[model samples]
Target: MGIKSFQGPRQKQTVEEIPLRVSDYMTKKLITFYSDQTIEEVISALIKHRISGGPVVNDKYELIGMISEGDCVKHISESRYHNSPMQDMRVKDRMIANVETIDGNMNIFDAANKFLSAKRRRFPIVENGRLVGQISQMDILKATIKLKSQNW
Candidate 1:
């Protein structure tokens, strides 16, 4: 029974497939830090990775906090005028607790917005309440830049 309206046939919705989500964009090889580590160690890790920051996890690989180069440098700046030795200072003394973390399965948009909003450059990707990987701002930029090449 054709009840003909004036409009022609509709086209099928073309969904631009975004294959790679945050997990695909994140750095699966994570180098995590412990809360007990000193600021010296944290700076070393940051330098080695060439990353601005990284996730601080417990022994069980739970995301606890984040350590950034800025955080370490802040102490350095403050201590420069004083006799306070930054070497003995631990990450627990400078690292920001209650940091925001994202799950590996989250979308790239979510991660990017977080980066724009926060004063951090790194984020830890957790799964099932356990640390699975780390996501840097670079990862998001790389993935989003090459969305077509994403294997998803």
Candidate 2:
């Protein structure tokens, strides 16, 4: 008899597709601060909201700058050495004026790339020159984990 070939079951792998957008993953419940707000108030707000920092907005809700824990640290250190109180320090004095913003329609992959290329932990999502939401590195990580789980 001729040699017999063994037949094995063929398995078809299924691919999972997940299209993620910044708006879908962004934190809609934003805790923003005003430029005129005192550093003491900003610090209290940050602690109350359990956030490292947030965008500084104007009366029209336009993103004017960004205030972060790092900025606060600088002010605190200087105030300690100068024997000055931080209560009078305004958010605008320590806020980063040159703010970089992202659009809500941006893809998660693109947002990941942007995070890799920058030192920012979060980006404010803006639409029509107004603050809409915020996206953080944690958000991107969660989206990636969700995508991986869907494949399993």
Candidate with top lDDT is 2
Query: Over the stretch 64-148, how does candidate 1's per-residue lDDT look in tens digits?
Result: 8888788888989888878788877888888788877777777888778878998567777777888888888888878877875
User: What TM-score does structure 1 among the candidates reach?
Assistant: 0.78
Candidate with best TM-score = 2
Candidate 2 lDDT, tens digit per residue, 28-123?
A: 888899988999998888888888999999999999999998899899999999999889899989999999988888999899999989878999
Q: Which runs in model 1 stand beyond 4 Å of their true positions?
A: 1-18, 148-152
lDDT of each: 0.80, 0.90
Stretches of candidate 2 exceeding 4 Å from the true structure = 1-17
Models 1 onward score TM values of 0.78, 0.85
Cα RMSD for candidates in order: 5.7, 4.0
